[model samples]
Target: MAGSVNQQQAVIYCRVSGAKQVREGDGLASQETRCREYAKYKGYCVLDVFTDDMTGKAASRPGMQSMLGYLHMNASKGSEIVVIIDDISRLARGLTAHLELRQSLAGAGGKLESPSIEFGEDSDSVLVENLLASVAQHQREKNGEQTSNRMKGRMMNGYSVFCAPVGYRYEKTAGHGKLLVRDEPAASIIRKAMEGFASGRFETMAEVKRYLESQPAFPNIDGSIRQQVVTDLFSRVLYAGYIEHEPWGITRRKGHHEALVSLETFERIQARKAERNLAPARTDINADFPLRGAVACADCDAPMTSCWSKSATGKRYPYFWCQTKTCGMYRKSIRAEKIDAAFAEVMHALSPAKGLVGLVKTMLHDAWGQRLAQANTIKETTKRDIAQLDKQLDGLLDRVVESDNPTVLW
Candidate 1:
């Protein structure tokens, strides 16, 4: 039995909550080292190391799942497996997760060993581990509640509890959160949008979208301006210089960030929105056009909007016309029937020749094979670069600290 236990395979599990915790020097690395030492003392062969830089409120961690899967795969081979952790809290922050993991490991004929605690298949040891886990969970909940209450008190005292909105930025003064106005190109577009609504230049939300898309200063997160973002910008009261926590319907005092538009301008924009909402809906006959915004007017470069009209004789005709009124070209509305025919003709022209198609397929297959080889080479190079950068950063920091000059040290 002692020989069998000595030949068992094991895996080390280490976790830290944040990258800052890892940098503090007594974290994941330290945990891994301690677990390795523990495994050596127990005479078990260490198979792998799994590290997760995440909170242990639950056990749905990637590293934890991989370790468990490895154990299950080796269980039927008569291979005994052990999971080693630095402490119980490192395994989980709550009792439920602890109890569930304990049962799971036991069911798989595996064991969990921690530097601070040991859990086995015995009833007495399991009871003690559960009790300790419960105490740790209770303390965690209490600390979380206290921190939330403190934050609430700070917010009520006119301190911002969250980061500043997109148009504004946070200014940390004496380690306290404060709001500051930052003028960005997006600010000009926001101001223009408000002005357009105020002066009746934009009649509806769609009109506002078109106007915004034409502006050079519009904000885009990833090369696309989503419709929801436009709607939120027009509806938010914060841009008008007032702050409201909508969940509680509580309006606070005016924010410290500079207002993008005057209150009067904002009010006028709201009035226009109300007017547009109350107006009777006009018939839009060309609503079925799929490429409505994709096509552009050849004369003025504005998007070509499709529309349909019914004559007195009950015949409906669809047409695409230019949007810009300033364009001097007098090309009449092109019939939708004619445009469809032209598109079909272009598609027919692109039908590949039989010989050309075969050659192109062969070329594509060869190119793909070369691309896979190149990708593998690049991946290996990137791994080496990352390892070198990590070592370089560590050495540079050490050298900087050893400098004699106080200014450089600071």
Candidate 2:
């Protein structure tokens, strides 16, 4: 009877609430130790141990999954395998997961075992197990709710919660969990930009972009500060020493971190925004004359617009006209042919002379030759590295033949 009992092979399964718990505490290790002791008392041979460092509430766990796959393999046929756990809750947290995992193991022909509870065929035992699983799930959810409440309390006390914005970086202090700190050059640069805008030095966001482009330290995407980034930067209230996150019901609370600009300056910027918002939308220029604003009216020296005019015979024609009301040529159409011909003549005359073109080509060829020399140097360096790597590989292969360890060859 004892010899037959020793034939029963078992795999131990253990779980913790989180990976942190696994590292800080011996939750997984302790569970395995207890499970192995129980398996030994039952005259069982322990084949493997599976440890999960994640929530037991989920149906999926890496270790548990691997153990299941190994136990259910074709080679394990005709052998009675038991999945031994310290407790049923170690297998799962919620009632759903507990029942699901139980059924799954049964389908895989794995007998469930624990030091605490006996695997029963009766309905009462199953009901007790489900109740225990429900308790574990409730505990897990309660802990999560408390953690969220703590974070919300911290936010309500006026500490920044999310990842730091562009001009700021998150720092950990002795008293504070996490707080924002001004990140250099970028912070000073942003502060200067904000002050410039508020003081009317930068009239538009476009002007601010031009200022940023002139700066060597401004963060840019593909060597350019995006217009939308500049526009979005103007609306951040954190620059004014306040936080305004609406999701947590927070609105303009004073943050612990330093401000880039004063609240009054921020308000003035907002006023400028509101004032611009009230302006009437500009009508789009006619695509018939794409160069209306770009090309000046030759007669009045003002920008020219284009429109179609209908003759008495009902024939329509497009012509360029001036937009200035005070000018004598205002609304007076210039023949489209005349404007088109002038533009073409200007463009043609702007090309470099033949001698200057040859000089530019020579300069370009000299630059190309320098780049070619750099490429050849890089190629030689790459070839040397490859040759060294090949020698190392050959030496390792020779050692592997002499070494007894199969892993050396591998």
Candidate 3:
């Protein structure tokens, strides 16, 4: 129904399911073309064209909100105003949205029109609109179901359904589609970290974190790798070439990607982890000084801490200082370079020569032989104790068979 050509003004509204559809295709453009042609045929003067790239089932959208505000602004005007859409499904796909939107349009004093469906002010027309809205809602719900199913299927096929881990990056392979691949120094660093923990090179999760921070190539959050990040990396099965997700009901399945650490090594790391629930927690020490707890202050017999001193020239110099203020040498700054050189000298002195190394090995072998001889003696004593216990048990059984006393028999 066309109003007077000179008196009527209209706005075109269009929408698509998602931004991906808009970018990869022309869904919005095609919808606009169809609506414009229909508006021209009816002699309606087009005022503005508003568009949205979002689901039709959603009642709140950026473009739709703006268009509603515009409708309210022109509601009191005496001129005839109309809102045109490509189809009713483009306006909304849910029954609740359909009914609510119809009321909202009426309240704004705006009439709705579409090229495919004729607008009528009668009972039959309202029934037809409601039927169409119900059908659209069904389609929207069915599409959601299919999408969820596809994601579950992918997860079951040895592919990660979630984001990739630290050492792996996602890529689209030639024939494999999207899959995970090893990512640079991060991968090598993580491999060393895991293997270190397994071999006792790194004793605790804190040690693992320090190892990662030492590597410049490894990514860090806020200038350090968070404790949670280290904990998650240790627990992930992807490093062992497996996948497990609870929400999707997926259990252990071999992954398509290569593994960084061996399965046996992963088990060792888990076994070495501290029983946090039972033991008193370890206090976190400042990691800036690796020798913080190891090296003792010569003056006070207390551990020293590392810090920096700012000189008059505004340059910072590294120093090791005692924290105990009551000590005689408290706050005495020792040059870090001197301490490092002294440590190197001590280590060099401790290195054994070839002849002394052989001497030590011979002594170690004699000590081991003595330990084995001692173990044999202990085993013989243990066997004698077991035989005596058995003899005592046999005597008790004979007494029980011969006695009438209730105490002994019972």
Candidate 4:
């Protein structure tokens, strides 16, 4: 009977909370070692070792599922396989998950065994197991809370603790552990794009997207810049040398990282965004109908829509039509050829006469001269404003230096 008991089959199960532990720590390996030692001490035949790198609170784990299937496959009428673990927490962090896995293992003909705790059918043993599982759950939750608090504190001190946005990467600094720094050509490209938008050079978000697409160094998904990314860039204050986290109650404050654009430019970008005209370029406009949106519907004054219509005899005809539901000519189609000829006639009608070319040139020269004078006046005004702001900033800095209380100013 002793020899038969010693010949019982067993499998080892080990787990860690995350992939970082699996890659950088020996938690899983050490757990497996301790479990194998226990199995050897019990004289059980070790069949396999299963490991999972995931949270214990998770109901289903790939390694756990595989071990269960293996146990069911090898189980015989009178033989049961022993499942060995280093500790109960390695099995599950929560009482509910522990109980569910316990039932599943028993159904698969696996007898639970651990080096740290002895498994028994008694009510007292089940109570101890449940208490330990609950403790493990509390520990997991506590750890999460501590980590969040630390990150929030770091962000409060003008350090970004979250993942770095595009054009920036994390680098280890002397005082700051991981700090955001400009990441090469992509940063330069983004700086130009943002400044262009802030200065009204790129009038619309569609123009910005096109500009980004034209840059060879800019990162792209499937060889195209996404509209959503452009939108996010416009609203992110971090690019303006400030940090803000509404969820953590961190208000806008100066960050330690170098800024790509000035706060003034960022504010201007926001002001322009309020106009609510940052619509993306329509993908439907193609070479087949170059004047689709350029030409207005005479009936409704809305841009005409273009499509190819198939006739009963299987012939395709390109046409432009008004799509405004409230218009009288809502679905009235105009032949593409007729519209093209009419547009050509209009262009001819509006063409400048040869005799008036010199007069038009002189008028443009005068307008250019006026613009130069206006720009000079604006430049002088901006200089005075900058000097006043500098004076105010100096006064604020003096106050910060005189104050000894940390909580008061912050």
Candidate 5:
């Protein structure tokens, strides 16, 4: 029984903040050495080491969670596990998180040990350990608050406080914290997308996505062009002359950076987006052509529906004809075969008329441009009307107060 108990081992958990910490000072290796020495002195064989280079304010860390899972799995099998950290702060910086981890470790029938602090079944030892943990938590909170204040100060001074957005690279400046601007290939693609959208070459966001996916320069992340990226690129105000840090709120800060496109162009793109949202939906006609909801008969104004019949050779045939009997139109069902052939003949005939084709294209383009202009005009008119209504409302209220008429004011 004693030999079996001796076989139980300890696991060392080490962590550091970033790559710089690991490269410059006492990091994973140093922590491991200390933990191993402590375990040896405590008469426990070191089994494994779990390290995480992330903030300990959260317990959802990969290494920490994995270690907990390992402890739970080994707990009931007569395997006594001791989780050793360099200190309690290495486990978690937050008091709540530290307490939660302690409860979890205790519940799992595992013990947490640190060289700096000792724990025992006795009340005095437990109290001392808890006090040390609380002190560590306080230190962590102070450090976090200091760091946050520094970051906020930097942001207020027109310095970026976080990572640069895609298509832009961050350069650290002496006086300014970080400067951001367009990066190669990505910048070119962004410019192209903006120009394409502005020039009406790309009619919809989907068309823009398709164009981006086709280019070797605009490679998709994770082998697919995400719809969100395209939408974000189009809507991002940073690309234009203005910068909006927080959208949909009053806490927006205008960034101090060079604009990639004009403010007018940006507004136009936003208007296009608004127009698309307001556009009437179109229905597919090819699949349901003969159905009442699909095609409208030119003469009778009734829907053309499809029907099946048998030929003399016992072969199946389909035809579309007018449903209204009282209407002065062809009563006999039009064979699908003859209609398809005639449609093809008409299309072929039209294909040869270059002048007509050019006229149709020009008319369609002009119609689209006119529609956009009309939409803009309507929007401007609506804004003016709203402003006028607000003025009238304020004046009416003022008059009501001056007249001392409670009913009129209400």
Candidate 6:
């Protein structure tokens, strides 16, 4: 029996829930050391050590699977190998996962052993193991709940607890834990895109997509930003320095972070999205067909569609024709040159009269004078307000310095 025990081989398995444990603490190293010590005490030869940096709730672990395969391939003809662990909880924190792994190890010709508990085939030993597994499972679930509650509580205090959006990144602050701060050129680019869309500079979301794709700094998959990403950017209220999470029951509230765009601009974007059924501008609308949609058919009054007609001689001619099937002149070709000349003539006729031009300039001059006067008045008022605020601030500082009474200061 002693000779057989000396010939037995053992494998060490250690697991930690997260990378932080491996980095900040010597969890895996400590577990392996303990397992190796146990193997030495049992007089078993240590074959190998496997480690996992993953949650115990998961049944599939790379290290665990590799160890199982090793056991299957290396078990001697009639001898079973011992699998050593620091504790049962190190194997798995979930009851289902523990049971599944237990069965898997047995099938792989591995007899489970841990320094904290002894493995046995008796009914009493099995019951104790199951109870311990259940307790570990409860601890994992409780830890998860506590983490979630803390994160939600921080979010309620106007701090973003989730991953920072594209335009922002989290920074650790003294008073406020992790707060969102503007992230450089990306923030500037996104601000311009959102403001442009709100102000009608970008007539459709397609224009916004193109604008983002043009910016080399903006992240893109396959050289183009997805339409869904642009939509999500516009939908996020976080750009306006606000936090909201519908799933967490959080309502829109002002955040500590600086806003990329004003609240007014965000509202404008929402209004524009609700008001328009925007579609991508046709790719064919270019210098060649500048009047494609602007020019209408004389018979149907519907906008004309332009196309280049190719003759048998292999020469192309630009023509504008009505696309409306019910129109009397539907598909009736009109020379684009003729349309262009007529358009120029109409524009000339629409030009302001010489006398009206002078009158319009005079009116604009008067409006400019009025605006200057209003601006000057606002400037003086702002100066006075700033002086008053400075005075009040000085008074408060004086009080704080002179008075030692904590109650009065509070």
Candidates in order: C-alpha RMSD to true structure = 18.1, 13.1, 28.6, 18.2, 23.7, 16.4
- Can you give the lDDT of residue 263 in candidate 5? 71
- The full ranking of all candidates by TM-score, starting with the best, is 6, 4, 5, 3, 1, 2
What number of clashing residue pairs does each candidate have, in the order they appear?
0, 0, 0, 0, 0, 0
Tens-place lDDT digits, model 5, residues 1-410: 13245565778899876667877877899999999889778788776789888877776688888888888877764555889999778888776787788888877757888897776879898787677767877887888889877866655555556666656778766766577766545665677677666644454677677677766545586556998888988887777745444532224355666566777777777876764321112232234333323444678765555556789999988677765666676555777777677777876886556588789899999977855765665567669989999999999878987886567755
Residue pairs with colliding backbones in model 1 are none
2 against 5, candidate with superior TM-score? 5
Q: Over the stretch 76-164, how does candidate 6's per-residue lDDT look in tens digits? A: 65689899999999999999999999999999999999999998989999999999999999999999999999988877888888888
Error of 1 at 93 (Å): 2.0
State, as a TM-score between 0 and 1, how close model 4 is to the true structure. Answer: 0.64
Superposed Cα deviation of residue 106, candidate 1 (Å): 3.5
**Which of the numbered candidates is closest to the native, going by highest lDDT?**
6
lDDT of each: 0.69, 0.76, 0.79, 0.84, 0.70, 0.85
Error of 1 at 258 (Å): 3.4
Global Cα lDDT for candidate 3: 0.79
Residue 217 miss distance in model 1 (angstroms):
6.5
What tens digits encode model 2's per-residue C-alpha lDDT throughout 3-121? 36437777888888787896689888888889989988988888787888888788878987887787788225566588899987788878788888888888776889898988788
Score every model by TM-score. Answer: 0.58, 0.53, 0.59, 0.64, 0.59, 0.67
Question: What's model 1's overall lDDT?
Answer: 0.69
Candidate 2 TM-score over all chains jointly: 0.53
Better of 1 and 4 by lDDT: 4
